[model samples]
Target: MLAVLIPLVLLMSGLSAGVLLGTQLGGFPLLAALPTDRYVHAHAFFATRYDPFMPICFVGTVVGDIALAVLAPEAAASGFYIVGAVLALATVTISLVKNVPTNKWVQTLDPENLPEGPDYEGKRADWGRWNRNRSYLAVAALVANCAALAALAVLI
Candidate 1:
């Protein structure tokens, strides 16, 4: 079980981390540079694409990590799996509490006539920051997953 789960967790974590890193490096900056109307449209487009994919990757990682931890509690790798699971869970929590609402709001907006005031910019910035934080958590989880694999290698 650990054999199968370890690799699965690593794959999900790697995918999540890579996408988030790309978004932080490329997508966010590109959107940030656009005019409000353009940003609104582009953000809506980009946001719609990541949906079920990212959530599946993230939740899959968490499940895999927890399974690994439980299945191999005697192994040194279990500690790393627990840490990885916590980090991955944090990424999900932030996405639900912070980023998702902002995404939902952006999707409803009219690009031609955005919010009346500075709220749009503030919300966008907050979304970017939350996403960046989630990215960091995902990267950290990937590192922990890698460390778990190494520990398993040594233990096995």
Candidate 2:
């Protein structure tokens, strides 16, 4: 069980990092560079692709961490998994509250409706910062989860 959980947790953490980075950094910049009509269509497509994946990754990290905490109480008693879970929660919260709203706003924009160049650049940059912050949190959680997994590995 411990062996299985460790790899699963790592896999989910890796995927969460990839998806978040791709959607925020990759997709946003790509959309920002395109012309208005293309931007709208691309942004909508990316969001549709992202929304389905994000929740599963987020929940998987949370559940995996919590399960680790429960199964290896001694390891979690040291607070590693707890800290990881907290970081993961922050990642989820920022994604839902900050990033998702920005994506929605971007979806509503038409090329005719937006100012040229720097206007969209500024908007994309603002949301990019949020994405970076979430990335940091996810990385931290990954570290914490890995630490707990390591501790469990040693114990077993």
Candidate 3:
């Protein structure tokens, strides 16, 4: 149990935080640099097509979380771990239910010919707010994972 839980917790924590950092340092900057009117739409569209990190991180977080729940009942059964897992799940859920669709909607807009109906700036603002919230979730997950790991270590 220790063998499995230990690595999984560490991995989930590390990867969660790492990806958050990447977004803060890389994705956010790139998005901010793009023109809000229509260039952002084209850039985001192409990025969704070419980017690999988001997919990898998403899969990793979901899989690691499920694994942690199964393998570490002590951790998963209550408190920080549960919060972490729930937040992790929420993070993915938001991405699926909100962000991906937003990106797809943006992508369909022509860089130079986007319809006036969709408020690009509003969308950008909403995305930014959600992304920040997601980052907070990631950070909380990382902390909770570490706490669980530490608890498990003390017991063992």
Candidate 4:
């Protein structure tokens, strides 16, 4: 079981971290710079692509980490897995609570007739902040996952 769970958790956590980091470093800045009309459309375009993929990766990572935490031979490895699970869970919670709703709200806008003001821009800023937070959490989870793997490797 460790054979399967170790690689599975690493793969899922790594993919989740990579995607979130890419969005933070590349995508968010571009979207933040766009005018409201362009931002709305661009956000909708980028947002839809990640729907099922990210959720699957994050959830899979969580489940794998939990399994690893329970099954690990070494107490340190199990602790690392527990930390990874918590961090991954935090990423999921933030995505559902903050980012998903923002994405949904962006999808509903007409773009052509968006209200004129700082309100919309503020929304974009808020979204970016939340994205950054989740990205950091995902990356932290990956690190914890790696540490868990390393601890197990040392035992062998």
Which portions of model 1 miss their true places by more than 4 Å?
none
- Better candidate number, 1 or 3, judged by lDDT: 1
lDDT of model 3, residue 6? 54
For all candidates in order, the CA lDDT equals 0.91, 0.75, 0.67, 0.93
Tell how far residue 109 is off in model 4, in angstroms: 0.4
Local accuracy of candidate 4 as per-residue lDDT tens digits, 1-156 = 788779888999999999999998899999998988999999999999987999999999999999999999999999999999999999999999999999999998888888656488788999999999999999999999999888988888
| Global lDDT of model 4 | 0.93
TM-score (C-alpha) between model 2 and the true structure: 0.78
Tens-digit lDDT track for model 3 on 1-156? Answer: 647665755675677677766777777667866787545664565546525655565556556655665666474333556666777777777777777787777767767676667677778777767777877877777777777666666656
Better of 2 and 4 by TM-score: 4
lDDT of 1 by residue, 13-47 (tens): 99999999999999999999998899989999999
Better of 1 and 4 by TM-score: 4
After the best TM-score superposition of candidate 1, give how far the Cα of residue 82 lies from its true spot, in angstroms: 0.4
The TM-score that candidate 3 achieves is 0.77
lDDT of 2 by residue, 1-156 (tens): 966876887788878877766655576567667875676667666766766677887788888877777777474534787787788889999988987887788777775566456465566677778888998888888888778767766766
- The pairs that clash in candidate 4 are none
